[model samples]
Target: MRANEGRESAIRAYTRYETLTGHVWRCACRARMLESEQRTGLVVYVDVSNRLQPPLPSGYFGNAAIGVTATSCAGDVVSKPVGYAASIVRRAIDMVTDEYVWSYIEHLKNQEDLSKFQDVVACGNPNIAVASWMRLPMYGIDFGWGKEVFAGPGSMSIDGDSVILSSSTGDGSLIVAICLEAIHMDSFKKHFYGGII
Candidate 1:
């Protein structure tokens, strides 16, 4: 879309995740009618599948993602152009590296039991977690029958959990799926589309 809009030359060439995450966070904040100064956050999962120096072997497969949080006041999220939030998201992401990943693992090791660990991301009302699977092998997943026609998370079981998936046709379109209270969906939809610039 940015290419079509001829905006690649813009100072900030936003990635798809940054674009959608910022837009969604703003719309969600407005939909919830959060107070102007209330702190709002977005937790985005970053894949470290290949961040290590030696890297995991080519066939390795497991949970290799970590979440990074970006925060700002609700007023900033709602009042600024999407690029403002995108910059925050980009900064958070840019901080991650092989060194950070190693340190994060050591931090995780300190937890007595991994099952009870929570990473300080506020879960329900004001924070959102976005997991992008756009670059994963979602469409190529096949079984005995055939390649699946569509592949996506069965549901967003919690409030503010979102997923970004590539369209099955791989036409460069994306599927953004998020869950919010029924009462807020209408307002959020309006803001999400209307604020597109």
Candidate 2:
């Protein structure tokens, strides 16, 4: 934690994902130079495997996650410390449970067009959609030939789209990758990983 007032001095605990996403959200919003009052959303994918009544079997290989958003104004992101965004992210994730999952499914069922479902959290500037694969067993995946050079959620086509993946070497490090506009890339790079041009 670099020196930034006494924001992080409080006795508070945050998961690695929460902390990173919170920081990234602040950076992304700052990079985009969004208005102070504009709504900014940090979309997160929450895993609902264990939240189910009967957990999915280990062999039940498939996506079991739901996308949630932790949103605040651009000013809030820039003004508040990392803990603010982290707390928002943590709250968003914690709000998802079995009932929430079921309600989400019902909402999906009621939707006339599923394509527009992501319009709320996933959009252009001031918004980011983060997908995390850190919990998945990815490093050991072999498609019958050999170890993969990289395993992730594929390329991020839109600005503010990002992915969090475990290191391929199984070294217990994370790869936090994001896609931003060319104009904003430098600023985002500076804020995301400082001291780098």
Candidate 3:
């Protein structure tokens, strides 16, 4: 497949994985919650900069991105097929307009406690955050010597967070770095790669 084709496939797969994982986490939370308590929904945060039209300036160095979240109940997400989850993700992403971006900035500006603006995972919520670094020129960076053989995130111990990075071979492939507790890693692995092969 061409690079774009591979990239699209990777995006779809990653989104599906994220949706499934978010559902799993939500279900886990429900299991732990009191019987009278309401089930906390799952929120999946997807990076929305690439979906923006008339993209930001090429050399713009500031944070030019916002996250769009797809939320659903544990039963709805875990019981439904992957296509259902994918559609939720697609709609959430499609809702990120230029106006929405500006509104998000205003919302941030209005916040009284910046410290409370924790990421989905850090907020003690049943949520997941996914960031893609697939198109970055990881292998093309050469200070003085030749290109580096391998490139990936500096650390990978953040639970409920996943980062998608380009393969080091410069091939049209991706490497998804996921961090989960030891007990849940096996089940996550099963759901992550079960039908993909």
Clashes found in each candidate (C-alpha, N, C closer than 3 A):
0, 0, 0
Judging by TM-score against the true structure, name the best candidate: 1
Question: RMSD for each model, in Å, please?
Answer: 3.0, 3.4, 6.4
- Candidate 3: regions farther than 4 A off: 1-55, 118-125
What TM-score should be assigned to candidate 2? 0.84
lDDT of 1 at 186: 95
Model 2, stretches more than 4 Å misplaced?
Answer: 2-12, 112-121, 195-197
The full ranking of all candidates by TM-score, starting with the best, is 1, 2, 3
- Writing each residue's lDDT as its tens digit, candidate 2 over 1-197 gives 32233555565577878878888888888888889999998889998998887877878878898988888888988888787888899899999989999999998999899988566547568789877878778777679988788678776778889988888766788888888899998898788776212
Model 2, residue 28: displacement in angstroms?
Answer: 0.5
Error of 1 at 38 (Å): 0.7
lDDT of 1 by residue, 1-197 (tens): 23124445656687888888888888899999999999988998887878777787888868888888989999998887777777788888888889999999998888888876664545567988888888878776668779786688986768888888888876898888889888889998898777765
The candidate maximizing lDDT is 1
Q: TM-score per candidate, in order?
A: 0.86, 0.84, 0.68
lDDT of 3 by residue, 1-197 (tens): 11122234645443534444443443343333313333333344444455456666677675555666666665555555655555666677668777787788799899998787674344233555566676667787887878776678888776556666777776676677766556666666565555343
TM-score of 3: 0.68
Candidate 2 global CA lDDT score: 0.81
